[model samples]
Target: MTADRDLGSEARQMLAERTADLQAAEAANEALRRANAELRASRAALAASEARLRLALGAARMANWEWDPIADVVTGSEGREALYGRPPGSMRSAPEVLAAVHPEDRERCAATIRRAMERMPGEEEFDAVEFRVLHPDGSIRWLRSQGRITDRDPLTGRALRAAGVTFDITQRREAETRYRVLFDASPFAVIVIDQATFRILDVNTRACRDYGYSREEFLSLLITDIDVLGDEAAIRARGRAHKTGERTQEFEAVHRTRDGALRDVLVRVEGLDLGNGRVTYGAHIDITARKAAEVELRRSEERLRVALEAGGLGAWELDFSRRRTRWDARLAAILGRERVDAEVANEVLSRCLEPADLPAVQEAFRQAMATGGDFAAEFRILRPDGEHRWVRCWGRLLPDQHPGHRRMAGVVADVTEHRQAEERQLLFMREMDHRAKNILAVVQAALRLTPRHDADSYAAMVEGRVSALARAHTLLAENRWTGADLAALLRAELQPFLTAAPEAPEATRILLEGPALTVAPQSTQALGMALHELATNAMKYGALSTAGGHVALGWEVTGEALRLRWEERGGPPLAGPPPASGFGTRVIEATLERQLGGTVRRDWRPEGLVVEAMLPIGTIRAR
Candidate 1:
């Protein structure tokens, strides 16, 4: 029984050991399966990465290639063969690929490879070359080749193979060529400046001519050397302000040339971040002519402003497209606006127009727009100060080729003062006509009262009286019918009858004296005519017939009355009185009594004849 129990125990121990061994084998197999799965995943990822790289190369118009130095085998990616316009993997060896290399670059390419191979193992090994390739279609392409020795012989010290990347850099090369052309041949002056030192880096041909400097001279100088027209600090500040962003900025500045001439230029600055350093590219456009034109335009505007102000004028523009109105400073002044930048609109102007005048204004605008007719309309505007003013607008159509919306521009002026003056003129004309008729009536009466028995006497007297009336009319005209200066009137009336000098009096001449006064227009003619009749009597028979004869005429203002005395001395002494008051006597009596509302009484003295007149001062206004 003890032996049987021991055998069972041994069998069970063996079974457990076998079971442990089986479990170990299963764990091992499980680990192997996981590792296989990971390997497959890694391979798939690598393939995907290579495909992505090729896609990237194609997108960039690039290629990748490899070469064996000993066997001279050429292998490349699909993108690599497309660089030379060939099928992928078509080339058999390095020489087969070299067949596409430009004849001039092939030898150099071979020499560069040989040199790279001669380097020692473990030495910094690299090969970089640029060469052109000829395609089957005969088109040329540029390629950039870069490589390094990947395998070398241990015993012979020979280059076995190289691992490299080659790319079709034709687009990049073409871009570089275009950049060079633009930099060298730009029309506006282009200057490249180093940001840190403000030193000139390069300049285009136009820059050299514009600045009056050679390329070498420009490159050697700093920005401060050329921007000589303004303060250096200011120019630097402007540049710094513009440099805050990479966007292109424009500014106007005066720059100095090599010959120290100042020139106005419009400068456009662009910031370039080239990774290694920052550079500023400036394009300078000569705007001296434009600046001069601007200055002249300002001067012209100033003159126009002065003229507009002086002429009480304002300028206006109606932009039909915008349904807006624009006005200048003069217009603002006319509108009584305080600000020059006052806003103007069609609605605002329309509201300013008087209700009655609006129709006329609208009709004028319509006519101008439809028929391109000259526009002249007078309207009334209520000023901001609540004063109404008359304004006349004159407009013309603006010539334009645009098919839609007409434009009219013109001037407006305040014609209030002019209108007032015109009214005054009309009043004066009517008064003149009335006064002229009255004088003609007085002349007719004088003629009728004259003696017809002596025809010659009548004619002589009429001529003389008419001449006196004409002289009075002349005085009124020169005074603008405002009033006649009393002294001036006397001088004018007696000028022809008297000698040149008044201080040196002559016999047979009339000498008159009076205080300075202004006679009313109404009284000037009457008083002038009265003086005429008295002087004519003295000339024919009284004091003025001989050189020794003389007349002394004087007047004085005495308490609401003008007492004037016309006295003759040393004349063919006047007989008592004219037989029957002659035409001259009637003229004197009618003018003084009826026209001036005064009386004329005569005092015939033995020495000469004295005519004393008493005139009411109330009729003659003093200015």
Candidate 2:
């Protein structure tokens, strides 16, 4: 039994050993498969990385190169060979590559190369340098070369061979230069401000000059400090508004300079999004003169509106170059037509002109154009309603020096009412002249009525009476003979006596007072004569002949009647009433009673004389 157990155990052990061998072999095969897969993945990764590198180089139009210090040879890739203007591998040595450097840049390039080769400990691994290189086509290109040591001396830590990339940076440099030129030379002021602090970040050349600040000084200031119209809080608000918004804004603001002068500017602000925060780009354009002009224009327009309305005028302009006419709305109304457009063709306006006066109008226009002169004429224009209306036309030529291209600006007025008024005035003058002639004839007849036996007294009376009539006529003429101010009439008649003492104040020696009363032309002469008689009596024998004597004459209106009183004082006494009416008294009674349609009454007092007159107010014509 021991022998059988031993043999079975040995068989089991043998089978276990064989199974373990097979498992080891399977483990080895799986490990080998994994290694193969890893190798393939690494190859794929390297290919992808190389492809990416090639794509980057192509995008940047850059070239890779290797320089060997020992061999003194410079090797370039297919792309670098193209930059050198040669076929691949045409450049054989470092000196050949260096030969392509521009003469002005060759030394600098060599110095850079030497410095890079002498890399010191703790220095940056990468170095970048820029230089100009002359291509085979005789064109110079700005090249930027960046490199690090690919092979170095172990003991000295010095670069033995270097590998780097080169790119044609000509376009970039040109773009940078163009930006600088535009930013520095623009006419309008430009500014950049930081969004968070509202502090000025940058300013252009114009900004420096316009704000009266140096570039360094301006950059140190907050935006609000330069704003004459706003404070810090407002500037902060403006900054906030620009930061969170995408739309641009335009505003008017007053900017103050370092010299404390204020300038009106129109500012246009827009957001500039950057990595740090929102930056504000602002443009300031001056509009001070334009603002003043606009204000003046508004005031002038207002004045023109008032004048047109007050004088019943209409403004017109003709642009001869375009043969276009423009007129105010009032022009159409004055022509008795529907309001026309402010601008219209010339023929449309010329259609209204009358042929009789058209020649004068045309001549005026021609003269203005030829001589750059003023045009003025009275013409007639028929309205659409078929009524002829007289119009006074006036104009002036603009662009005075250039007659060929000019505008005719003018005023037009309807003169029908004025012309009719003038005609009426002429007719009235003729009537007044006829009436004056009749008055003279009446005076001649009255002179014949005077007693010839008292020749000296008759001549004196005739002269005084004629003068009184003449005085009345003058007063009426002064008013254009419309009527006379009753007060003025009395003053005129009493002028000789009232001012007899020039040293005395006016109207004090012989005081006169009355309500404003304008007597009609028919009554003015008669009333003036009556007052003259009374004044003559006072001067000859009554109040005016004595010192400290006066005559008080006054009138008031009541119940459509004028109650007037004349009181003489401080003069010779009247012992009794006149035995009968004298020439002067008779003249006063006749003139006042018949011509003025009034009555006169005389009272004989002990110390002086008093006269009361009743005149109808309706006849006096108080206007």
Candidate 3:
């Protein structure tokens, strides 16, 4: 049984060995099948990945690329080949790539590639760069390359190859350049600033020129640094408005220049949401001249005020648009107003003028405005308190002076006292002239009644005659009589002398020549008495002794003299010197001497007696 068992065991052992070998072979076959399945899956995935990559490159207008740094081999995509004006698979080495790159940028591209390779192996970083490529056809192409280190040796941890993509970006680069140029050369001043800090982020050339700050200097500064408004409150308010996303419209503000000058600017500010916070974009329009004009206007107003005060004159303005009148304090006071309302109308101002004088005042004002002429009006004002006072108003026109606005303003004055004083002075001068004439007439009359003597007596006689003449003047002035007629004066003075010669009046020859002339009171009294004495003497001895005898008496002002002449022809022979100087002769001599300041000569000739008197032209009377 052992032998048979041994034999059976041996057979079983051999069978078992065979079964084990078969099982082992089957297991190995199953392992190979699993490896084959995995290989097939990997191959499928790789094909799909390659297809997807190709589709993506085509969609982006790009081509795939590779580089073997260790071998200095370069492989480019179809797009890269096209960029170099060559067919696909044309680039075979780094030297070829260098040839394709522009000569100016070739070395720089190599350097950049070297730097990329040095850092690539462990976890390559994606990088992008731009360079110009030259083609065999002599054309230049702009290219953008995006790449990463894909094939690296794990053991050495070194980049063996790099994979990237290339695209033709010539048109895009040109567009970018044009946009930059336009932004730089724009006319409006543009500036970008960080909203929170108000720090300048960017500024255009126009902004730099307008603000008088360089780009570097402006970027370092805050908006407040350039804002000329020194008030901190206003700056803070503007900052708050910026943060609230409000679109600031045009606003006028002052800006400080590099030279420390102030500039007026109109600013438009807009907020930009940059994902982190807000930034401000501003456009500035310089209006410095306008601001200066405003300041000048204010100064002009101040000057006007000073002028009015210095001239002691009042000022007034009328605004037709506002329907108001602005009357200065002095002008209101002249109208007896305690409280003045500038809002009053023209009618109210006119009411202050006297009613009877209103038409003249209105006419003057109308003419002044119509012709743009200087205005002057004198009128009485009816004060609020019922007192009537004179006022003189003067004005000048200012036309087309206010730009974009119509306005007129001028000064007025209260000249009542001045006008009144002038009138009073004229009246006083006239009275003085009358008084002086009266005094001269009185002296002439007083002199005519005195006796002839030496220079001293003559002076005394002239004075006394003047006194008597003054008395006569007083009578004339009492009646306001200007003068006496020739007939009236003769009749009044010769009445006493003619008492006995009533019938023999014709015997006396008194021949008066020339036109009748009137004489004032003093002249009449003095000359009348002298003439009466001469007539009486003629009647007694000179020419009136015989009816046939005749006497001639004539008076005239010829050239420069008041002359009187008396001649007798048929009377008794010429008489010798008188026994004494009679009152009549003295009166005649004094009359000629004092009143006419003249010489009288009496001569006794063979035929008759002749008397002639000559007076100065200055003392001659005017009719």
Candidate 3 lDDT tens digits, 201-306 = 9988888888788899998988878887665568767656545345554577788888888888878878789999888788888877877898999999789778
Cα displacement (Å) at residue 13, model 1:
52
C-alpha lDDT (0 to 100) for residue 302 of candidate 2: 92
lDDT of each: 0.81, 0.82, 0.71
The clash numbers for all candidates, in the given order, read 1, 0, 3
**Residue-by-residue lDDT tens digits, candidate 1, 1-623:** 99999999999999999999999999999999999999999999999998999899888777666777667787777767777777777775877777778999999888887788778888746788889988888889999888888777889767777778888788888998899888888889998998788889989889988888999999899987878644557776776666546557778888889988889998999889989899988899999999999999999989988988888789988887778887777766777765435545688778777878899899888988888888899888877888788889999988889968778888998888888778869977997899889879867876887567789988887777777778888888898788888777777766666752244354337777888778888888877887777777776777776667777888889999888788888777555766677667777777788778888888777778888888888887644
Report the CA-based lDDT of candidate 3 relative to the real structure.
0.71
For residue 394, model 1's alpha carbon misses the true position, in angstroms, by 1.1
Residue 511, model 2: Cα distance from true site in angstroms: 6.2
Candidate 1 weakest ten by summed lDDT? 499-508
Q: Which is superior by TM-score, 1 or 2? A: 1
By lDDT, is 2 or 3 better? 2
User: What's the C-alpha lDDT at position 582 in model 2?
Assistant: 68
The estimated TM-scores of all candidates read 0.63, 0.62, 0.50
Model 1 scores a TM of: 0.63
Model 2 TM-score on a 0 to 1 scale: 0.62
Candidate 2 per-residue lDDT over residues 1-623, each given as its tens digit: 99999999999999999999999999999999999999999999998988888778767778888888878888755478666555677677777777777889888888888887777755648777788877777887888888877877779876678888888898998998799789989899999998678889998889988888999999889888889745777765654554534547777788898998888888888878888798888999988888889899999999988999899999888989889998887887887766766678988778889977777788888987778779999988998888888899889877657656779898999999888778869966896887778688758856876567787988987888888899999988898767888898999888878754554554466888878878877678878888888888888878887776789999998898888898998889889787777667877777778757888889878667898989877776734
Off by over 4 Å in 3: 1-66, 72-87, 90-127, 130-182, 185-188, 196-199, 211-238, 241-267, 287-293, 313-358, 365-408, 423-623
